[model samples]
Target chain A: MSPVSQTRSPLDWVKTAISRYWGVVGVLIAWQAWVTITGVNSIVIPHPINVVGDLVFNPGVYLANAGQTLFLAAAGLILGMALGTMVAIVAWSSRILSGILVPLGLIFSSVPVVALIPVLARLLGYDVKTVLGIVIIISFFPAFVFTAAGLKSLPPGSSDLFKVFGASRWTRFVHLVLPSAVPNWMIALRLSAPPAVLSAMLAEFLMGKSGLGFLFRQSATEFATERAFGTSVIATVISVLCFTSAVAAEKFINEKWK
Target chain B: MNAPLSSAPATAPEAWAINVDHVGKTFTLDGGKELKAIDDVDIKIGQGEFVALLGPSGCGKSTILRLVAALEDVSTGRVTVEGSNPTALSRAHRLGVAFQDHALLPWLTIRDNIALPYKVAGRPVDDKRIAELLALVGLSGFEKARPRQLSGGMRQRVSIARALVLKPDVLLLDEPFGALDAVTRRHMNVELQRIWSEQRITTLLVTHSVEEALFLADRVIVMSGRPGRIIKEIQVPFARPRSPDVQRTMEFHHLADELTLALEPEGHH
Candidate 1:
């Protein structure tokens, strides 16, 4: 059955929208109510309305920082996935290589990736490249692990069929092994993509001159609470967008592939 | 109907398209214990002959087919096709095969799935041959349909079409309809018989169904489980271009019952 069913009526669309987004809506309403009840000083914690005003009024500032962060995250995610897939294929091909690399990959994945950012910044220099590296490192493990598993889980008896047909190594990889890994690769993407955005922002926050992370830091230091709150709101939106888009892509591919 | 296992002639090697020369296969278990899957099995399929290996589950009839398909190495003796090693036939892209799972690539359309042999063989896709096969399998209009869109029987048909597209010297079918319902399986046997009559390619089918074996094969070799060995061999007396009504005949039932009795456990009444 198709997961992307069409809505039959306007009422159906509204019901679906509420079911999907009620949690986020509820959180927003609670935050607004708390701000109104407290009557807190604006400099300490600005009203939700004030944060929205800053976002609406100063689109140019937010746009430039957001664009930078988006580019870094997207670029890092693609490179990481590509590298992971290549390594996985190499591991699949050579027993010795997999024996050495798979365990190492596991170890790297187990360590807190966020903790590595400051150390990486010191070694790689405090720049955009480090932020990109952080994002890449964060995204790599899931892709590598999932792709390796997928490569092994071919359709039942397909490996035997290919052997009987006398498929060349490269031909088998292209026609059988690579395509087999697609669904699992989509899974890696869904798991890694949202984290890619978060890692990029965190790297920017630690040691960077631009991006939403730096904007947030600058606003907080200067007592511009509304701007800081606006950056957080934008960051949350971007992260959620990444997650949803990855999920959508996965569903679309699985419909055709599975 | 049961004949001595070794009575098969050891004459001209060229006449035999697939020759399993006293083959045996053993597997090393995870615990390092040896498990004998097949032992001292011999089968010689003549050129354009249809032979079916019928046995119960775990009887290693499939292992025999796998040996001839060059998918597994025989622990003892050898398997040859057309006077050369079985692997050689595979390397030449002259071996066709279908299994219980169908094994069609789900992402591809029916036409492309059938054309996969050509792609694997590094030959240009033959559109005419693919069309011919699609029609041969009675799936001509389903060229654009992916494997997921088709029924199980339809998918198996596509796998069969793909196997035959290359016009291989030998066809190996390992329970190609084993997963289908009774009605569909019977229908498929009729379809396969019709298809085989046109091509007349030498085929070796592994199955558990006595009726199916009797219906589709010129000869049936039944095996006993546990270090599998051929226990009974029967030359089917049914004429070519056999109709489904042949199954209702007394002679067919007589053969089926005999084979079924042979398949039963020794102590079972």
Candidate 2:
């Protein structure tokens, strides 16, 4: 892929980008055309230009709420992943613990995390902490499931090698098992990141006083369609950023590991 | 430490480095069926002896190696290494092993992979020892290379370096070259012969190749498959520091033929 790309000129990069993102460009063009053709009221469905205009003109408002949402998402993601990995290690250390925790994990994963947000908000008093809790719960399932599976995926004959080397449980876990799980852990990260952003926004929309979700809700309630659409655009960009960064991180780690 | 099974009086206690006393292993399959992997296998190695257990695939040769490596338990008998249980030898960090898969950690450089045993045993890393081993395995200047960057043969060399890094009392190899191409395998055997001569650790190599067994072992114990049992034991006559040229000799061919014939199916034999 690199060799072929190197042979091509700068124009090819433009061509590749167009090929990759044509669908998005086409959708934007179609949305603009529909709004212009239907002559819809700007209050009902603002033009894309109006949405972009609101984003550019109201940078401070969007930035503040985006900052809050980003903080909640990033913090919840890290804490949830850390908690899940710790639980996975504990389960791996004992068969009885694994037998109990794995089924409970499956059950928890099966239920929709969004449904728990309202109940949790009621219990935790409809605050930022509840929003954070919702994000953490949303992100925890993949981390736990993927990490549990990853801990068991030892490289071929590595278990035998460790046993033959007289490695204690701690030694094996640190040197062998933990490193083996990294690739799978990265997968969990990539899977959970986008949802983490979305869940944080959802939680904020339901009951928070700030964040992209609350910003969207407040804008829509006030009939500020352009600001609401701008909020959505910002949320989408953040989600995409999270996904691409996770993918980049996964690629870098996989290259170094394998 | 003396072995717990001291009642076996046929041999003196300390002379044997590894003693597999009538060891048998039966694995219970799913649905309550029993599969006997090995049956009443008895073998003993003197200090510094290079013994080979040669058999076909699924002949339980690897099972015997596993028993000695303390990776598997013997059902009916005991396997003692260095006058104690195999586990004792391993726990003391006195056993080294290499397998067909070349089980070097992909994440580590060659140098770190070779240095792993020291880390596992809670010893400080010995840079000089690791360098010496890298040089000995003909892998000098390749220290920073990971296993993936190396060829199949080079990866095997790294695994061998890791096994020998601690100067272990016993080196157990189960088909260490079984996955290599024939030419590379032969070359590795030559390199291994040189390596083994330098250390002279009590070694037990398990292989299915007749030539490999004849070329490497001081004594080759051949086993039959399906409830594996020893079929023959032949003492190799080639002197130590044996060159690869000895493989072309008339006596070597005769021995190779004999072992090959023994390894055939029962009717053919």
Candidate with best TM-score: 2
lDDT computed for candidate 1: 0.92
How far out, in Å, is residue A239 in model 2?
A: 0.6
DockQ of 1: 0.81
Q: Give the count of colliding residue pairs in each prediction.
A: 0, 0
Off by over 4 Å in 1: A1-34, B1-9
Candidate 1 lDDT tens digits, A1-258? 438567488888898899989998898889889878988788887888888899999999999999999999999999999989999999999999999999999998787866898888888999999999988888889999999999999988899999999999999999999999999999999999999999899889878899999999999999999999999999999999999999999999998898
Residue A52, candidate 1: alpha-carbon lDDT:
89
Q: Which stretches of candidate 2 lie over 4 Å from their true place?
A: A1-13, B1-10
Lowest summed lDDT window (length 10), candidate 2 chain B: B1-10
Cα miss at A40, model 2 (Å)? 1.1
Two-chain DockQ for model 2: 0.75
Cα deviation at B185, candidate 1, in Å, is 0.4
